[model samples]
Target chain A: MVLKVGILGGANIANKISRAINSIPDVAQVVVVGSREASKAAAFIERNKLVHASPVAGYDAVLDFPGVEAVYIPLPTALHVEWVQKAASKGLHIVLEKPIAIEDEHVDAIVKAAADANVVLFDGTMWMHHPRTAAMEAALQEIGPVWDVDSAFTFKGSADFLENNVRVKADGDPLGALGDVGWYCVRAILWAYDFTPPTHVAAHHGALFNEAGVPLNIAATLLFPGGRKARFLAAFDTVFTSKLEVYGDRGSLRLRDFVIPTAEHEASFVVATANGLADGDTRIATVEETRTVRNAVTQEAALWQRFAREIEVVRAGGRAPEYWPRIAALTERVLSAVLASARQGCALLPFEHRA
Target chain B: MVLKVGILGGANIANKISRAINSIPDVAQVVVVGSREASKAAAFIERNKLVHASPVAGYDAVLDFPGVEAVYIPLPTALHVEWVQKAASKGLHIVLEKPIAIEDEHVDAIVKAAADANVVLFDGTMWMHHPRTAAMEAALQEIGPVWDVDSAFTFKGSADFLENNVRVKADGDPLGALGDVGWYCVRAILWAYDFTPPTHVAAHHGALFNEAGVPLNIAATLLFPGGRKARFLAAFDTVFTSKLEVYGDRGSLRLRDFVIPTAEHEASFVVATANGLADGDTRIATVEETRTVRNAVTQEAALWQRFAREIEVVRAGGRAPEYWPRIAALTERVLSAVLASARQGCALLPFEHRA
Candidate 1:
């Protein structure tokens, strides 16, 4: 009953997923590692200690592997659309890395291909699968209608990373920070609003660009209907910060580590319910409640487990879940709008769904 | 000799300042309470237990009180210019409440009057005098050039407040939340950047306006030269939160209560120095250090003490300090630009110094 998974590249992120898959034996296991060079794939498997997985010379071999029910694509951003469509054509489900593609059209193409093949597709935003996320969602619901969300994910890149990382290269990542860290912020915001898209997006000025013209640091605000708004800051040029705060009419939720919890097994978020100010006091007092959740597996493993569960449902002749690809598409659309806004002098760009 | 201070209009905030003045008997003392009705002023004095201060029938009577050496003006927003001018003409040093005036021209007139009378002038942003502010500033320097500053100040308003508070009235505190809570966020941002004005400012959409068109909640971004930036969120419709985060190349500073210390005597901030992530890690490892400062006096008392020191210097024939008024003007200018940007469909407005 275990789902056999294939990894499509030797990217560093693949190491983490390989380890995650190795930890969850009953749900799923990575059985194949694919790369242009078999030796590189073997090295990746060895370094990550994936003893059960075998290395293959090319991605196509992984797609064609008889036992591979799903493929985890950690390929560079430029290679996503082609490989995802090919995987779909081969009837394999997908666990795609975030910033699923450089642009929305590519995402549309991949999504359409997945639909055509009736395959389960999910983006690898691991935090979305964490139990803490569910707890936060329940807390937000208790807080009343959310009116504001602020999130940030930033980390300082080393000199070598700035110079040679695929993220800073125009053809490699193209979207750079917006596609990498920004993906998490955007997804978290959307999740806070139950996958509803904002009506308009505006980039804040002072976006930093790499030599290849990809954004290295950026910030933007998303305005939804009914005065609901969200803002996010994503950067590869600042010290590490991963925080999200959601404000509701009656309360608020704040988490210091939203993208990745400080501990693998435990996560916490603070909820504050408004108590209004005491008589003649300048500040309003609130009861701050901290909620903590413990998980038996890492968030990445949970993500893999969820993907496997969906794949099993599809294998049983059930329809592929539409919600996964829908959110992925929405995340891509908002990111593209932010980039467009940044390029056009931080203008407010109306959100339009192309797919 | 202690500076003899006069209170104007009997605003609720004046009670805090009156207590601050009473606490520092060797430095300054409240001598008079002024209001349209002598009985109301007397009631305010009795309620606040200011036994040494006498109540005056009118604000001008407090200004003309022979022993009044200074004035603390907490009148409604629309009356700031007139009272400040009269206080200056009486050759009294002045401690004015924030949102010093509604517009740049009004601030210009106040600054001119203070200069013409050669009196010390300061805005009543009490946190500016806290020892923690100095400690945080020193830590920011160690963190290197600040490239980003984020601050927020918000408090929930009661039904009575939303309906009857002067802040929501068109003719009372017309600037509303921006003038009240937002002024603190803007001041903190400018202070973090050493009062260097940003090059441009833009308001985010979703600014909530009252029936009289006063902002109840707002967010904005300020872009400085060299890719440095600041952002602020101010609201009267959310749970209370006052946070400031400053990011630099090497480190960052985070304060949960930047506008007001949670405790009167002790305040703390966290500083994180980037150590670079371990190889193959997703986030940079940081050394988090928390710094705490203990103050013998409340921030309000510290503010009054600082004002007294400045008045002492001016009384000794030194010129009034220009830095105080200069920063006040800059904060107002940026606030005005944010309002302008918010009105113009969130357009990026170029920063200009009208003073």
Candidate 2:
């Protein structure tokens, strides 16, 4: 059976999802596109040449479509809580783009509603579905117990994404850099490091020049229960770069240019190990192989296909994995820490968990 | 009046002092050069082609050099405490290389002897001599009360400086990274943030390869009194990279390529601040300047020349600044935390000052 989806906002993410849904094998169909203005939704369909769609105004019309079984939310951050709750009430499975909500209460409501409705709910964190994530993780494990995890994602800017656009809003402000890129780094650590919840979270965030820079760059450190620690940095106004290195006892695993992967190949962390104590006995550690994929485009396509597989799991009368709620909770937890640190101008310790 | 000096080792630092002492107008002769091996000392003298008398064989020869009122200790990590104490007993003022000792006892003895001798003792942390340090600090002050300071120093291994070489033997051992590059990054935070001594210490360290492999890297966070925090990453088995960034309420100040600076001149940090809601103007608060030095080598030369200036203060018979002991004490304190974390693989809270 096909899962017919209605996109609730005509945003860039909607375009990406339309492409993804079109590519996935008989899993999802984008039947309707809705915006506050009918012309806007119609324009999106016309521009993308989306053949199968009902151009509608307001979210209710999208929900009223008989074939729409799931809702793909690409609305402003502030609208997530309301729409996700509404979609759940209408018995629609949901895919909410990160951050899910700007405030904790909004996230709380959405999480509780999804739990009560017993429906599939996932945050559109694309990298989690990337094939290379598993390969890089397995390679890291070969090195043994991880001692440190560090990540960085930096870029000069996205001028094209700006220019009086959708994220440029009053109360519907775009999430800060931490909310955007930092979330990915946080997820990368979560996935690699046994999905441990951070015991202590400390963060530093700052604005940039363009697009009402919402904490465009942030640096945060998460301390786990064991002496294990992870540090991450995300930025919009820095030179283009992203890397993840997991330093372990026996060796280390590194993914250079992680967030913005290169085409046709992958990079590995150069390893070094001791051979023996005798003079001239030492040797450079072996370089293990990592799963090489194409660019971010292919990685994204691979993940969306996997997510489409999970749609079958959702259809089988069970439930989507709790990974989505857990990720939602963690993102909120980290974002809260960043805000507290920003307001206080000092490290916030014993970070408050979402009750 | 000249402040006569004698050298006890032929390390690279000793070469730097030769140049500084030769160039300074207030300096005297390079009276003596001593090493455990006579040929090695002679080779150093021949390489520099100095006017000093023949290179001496025993440690005592330099201790007994005529008119030598001060000593520069640029020897191996383990040997620092012994020489500092011996030099102190002989009433010789000293400029000690960093990691004053690989072990706490070594630092304790050096601190005690310096106090007992009523003579000047300085750690050769020459990066402090860079004018930009003061500039960065001044900018930090303007930003508001600081909450976090992040620092890193990493570089590819120098084949010539492999583990077990006398200079790095102790530091290249299982937990060596804690005392080697780790000390500098730790000190940068302690000094930059002026954080109080920690009450507890925890660390996580492991072989970049295995136990027998050299400890090539360390990542640790220190918690100070009153909720202040500092985090750092230091390594000898990665790319040559260094950075120092301080986060405050109003904005942040960052210095890129810190350990080994770049010729582009000024190190930069983008200070981000949010405009009022009405203005909707958020941008980097600009404060740009050029470093003006060629590279790390030239920058290092400038640092030693500044070290010579401190000799002027010593010549005046004044006590060294209060910040010195605090900086030294914090280094040992944080290193202890790093070691503890490495041993236990958990975040150690509130590092304690060693007894």
For every model shown, what is its TM-score relative to the native structure? 0.97, 0.61
Candidate 2 lDDT over residue span B306-333, tens digit each: 5455556766786544355456755865
Cα lDDT, model 2, residue B5: 72
Candidate 1 ranges beyond 4 A from true positions: A275-279, A282-286, B275-279, B282-286
Q: After superposition, how far is residue B10 of candidate 1 from its true place, in Å?
A: 1.1
Q: Provide backbone clash counts, one per model.
A: 0, 26
- Model 1 quality (TM-score): 0.97
Minimal lDDT window, size 10, model 1 chain A? A275-284
Candidate 1 lDDT tens digits, B81-153: 9998999988999998988888778989988999999988899898899999999989988999998889988
lDDT values for all models: 0.87, 0.63
TM-score of chain B of each: 0.97, 0.83
| Docking band of candidate 1 | acceptable
